[model samples]
Target: MVTPDLTTSVAGIDFKNPILTASGTFGYGLEFTDFLDLNRLGGLVTKGLSAKPRKGNPPARVVETPAGMLNAIGLQNIGVPVFLEEKLPKLRAYDTKVIANVFGATEVAYVEACEMLGEAEGVAGIELNVSCPNTEEGGMIFGTDPAALGHVIRICREATKLPLIVKLSPNVTDIQLMARCARDAGADAISLVNTFVGMAIDVERRRPVLANVCGGLSGPAIRPLAVWMTWQVHQAVEIPIIGIGGIMNARDVVEFLLAGASAVQVGTASFVTPSASANIVTELEDWLSERKITSVRELIGGLELPPRG
Candidate 1:
């Protein structure tokens, strides 16, 4: 039998495979060189980059939950200029694609970061971390408000010629509306279910587990919701979708594909096993070959449903 093909294209960029490491969990991609060959995976998204470096939140920023974890790291990073000057050059040596994740507290900040990354080399695309709050708008999250979401995407869309992928926030009443907003505003592709808003408490101390009081929830816990949103967004827009949630193995990756994702990102799983993303790339190939699946693309939106009674 011929080897299964895992290659996929999103937002006009060709990926060797469908598995790219999620932003914060994967660090700068160079950090994992000792654990796995970076060239083996489809791509890697750098930590959230802003116009300037941030000190992030104080201590107690993360906590492990039942089947997942909650984090409010405050999008800390070395800033856009520093990443371009220091990291991008080193990453250019690897054969894999490098996607930069951009974050901002306001619309202007978003555009600034996009412009900076747009001028840099070795970046295949820009994934907008719109899940951030819009300080200019009284802290309204750009991803939750349809109008705000569209505005930020439109300006950033104009700021960069590279592919623009808007990562959606799940804490909203209408996810499909948000997806449509992203597409109509000129997003090249969409990545869904950034993280569910959640919080944990210490019964004895009677205080929030994370210093930020509330944090984003990620892991297998959000997989079902993520898949459902992926399917909903698939029906809402024509652009490609990169599904994200509790994907621990190839089967989980297959679940998102069947639901309507051209590709998927591995987030929390990387924390459990540094090589989780690379392992999934190989496991996905093995999974398809065992079933005689010629190309992984065949699984996209292949979910079957019962006919109406």
Candidate 2:
């Protein structure tokens, strides 16, 4: 079988492939070591980490929907100090690239979080989770307003030399405007469709299924919308775009790449299969090889649009 080259560069950081474990879905990337070779995949994005340890939201935080899942985990994490002192050392031993997913309620909090990750060794990049719908104050607030989004991006840009990948929120009127804002503010790259706001209820009890009442919806249910949004952002910005939101198999990854995504993140699928990310990497290679494609780059933004009427 012909070996197709899967390595791709995003925001100056070179990844072995375009597959990355989405933040929040994959714990610290080390948890799955027993299930899959951590280095066999592209990269690992740590769960959303805050300036300080967060207790997260109350119990009953997750619920299964029709074709997706809703989660209001509230960015629960071990905080930066513990992550650097404990997780970083172990992650550095692996050959895979590690990207820290940072979040905060205030601009200072965001800057501080990035600054902490910036000083940590073995971190290939930083993915600002500015659109987390689970948070009470910050999260989506920093991602919705153009001015506020620009402000946060600008602040974090100065806080870290690591590739700054701004993960965007889908809960907005114009995601294109926000994409442009991140690019104009000096973001190295951007990831999109952080999970659409959704909710579920126990009809018999007349109460919300999730303790938070509302949470972010993810999985196949949002793939179509995610692809559309990724395409729109691709048209609006120049920086590398990492597509997120219901990607499941190798074919789904191709759809995102055709829509102009430099890479793609697998989230909810990980919950279904521990080795989903690594398996997708293999599937992608096989698919490319079968078509005599030498590299994944050829398919990036290669979607052929129908001629205008």
Candidate 3:
């Protein structure tokens, strides 16, 4: 009887399943419709949206490293108004959960993005990208400071009625404080950890490989750190946690759920396999059925680690 079709509700918004595509990695939900059925996903978190269109960082903004990738995409996105006018209609037709990713260079920009999304139709919820570290002034790099995190969340809180999921950074000294701040500031849910800030050298050129020099690190290399952070934050706060980073297969998905995440975001994996979400979702279902579980929700944080002898 165990079925992957178990429904999950986070912050009052319901998801058909818990597996979803991370923002930036998955373009507007419509873009993937040709490659894969839009309805197969548990949810779709769209690319980051700003108050205004962004050109993003200059050339050579992404560099491939062994095991991980560095990205300084700078939250490049079309402005909120355009998304509302153009993308929202096409997205609204999809059968999956519709989560919008909002970003800003300033608290005001954050508020504006949310306020706009709030007014748009068919958008299920909002994911606050307050901690992205790639921007010059506002990206989440500032959120490592609790006061700033609180301020940014509160600002967005004032602008919308949709469920708010605050995304946190991994670069902070105490990730818990940031997660707590978001919850305390009225966030309905929390997601972590965003890419770790990292850089690489060209060696041959004697300079950084990426033109931005520094970017967020993602992939299997940061999976342990991400799981640790997710568990810690889930224990510290009352809001639901959506774990991200290095999710390559079914076991990794189970690890995140056992680590206390109510949901998981699959990022980089989608780059090579556009159908990655479909496979992960199916694998999760098969694992649950084989384990004799009747519902996928039963797997949420169902881990019991061995005691120290």
Once superposed on the true structure, which residue ranges of model 1 sit more than 4 Å away at CA? Answer: 132-140
| C-alpha RMSD values across all candidates | 1.7, 0.9, 1.3
Better-scoring candidate (lDDT), 2 or 3: 2
- Score every model by TM-score: 0.97, 0.98, 0.96
Clashes of each: 0, 0, 3
Cα deviation at 279, candidate 1, in Å, is 0.2
Q: Which candidate is the best by TM-score?
A: 2
- Candidate 2 regions exceeding 4 Å error are none
Compare the candidates by lDDT and give the number of the best one.
2
lDDT score at residue 95, model 2, on the 0-100 scale? 90
Q: In candidate 3, which residue ranges exceed 4 Å CA deviation?
A: 1-5
Q: Give the TM-score of candidate 3.
A: 0.96
lDDT of 3 by residue, 1-309 (tens): 635455787888888888889988998877777678878787889898998999888868887777879999887788888888888888777788888998888888888888877756788889988777687754665568888888888878889998999888888888888888888999999888888889989889999877788898998889999999988887898788889998988889889988888889999888868888878888888888888877767777777879999
| Model 1 lowest lDDT segment of ten | 132-141
Query: In order, what lDDT does every prediction score?
Result: 0.90, 0.92, 0.84
Greater lDDT among 1 and 2 belongs to 2
Kindly list the per-residue Cα lDDT of model 2 for residues 1-309, writing each as its tens digit.
779999898999999999999999999988998889988879999999988998889989998899999999988899998999989999999999899999998999999999877757799999998898987754689899899999999989998888999999999999999999999998999999899999899999999999999999999999999999999999998899999989889999999999999999999999999999999999999999999999999988999999999
Worst 10 contiguous positions by lDDT, candidate 3: 1-10
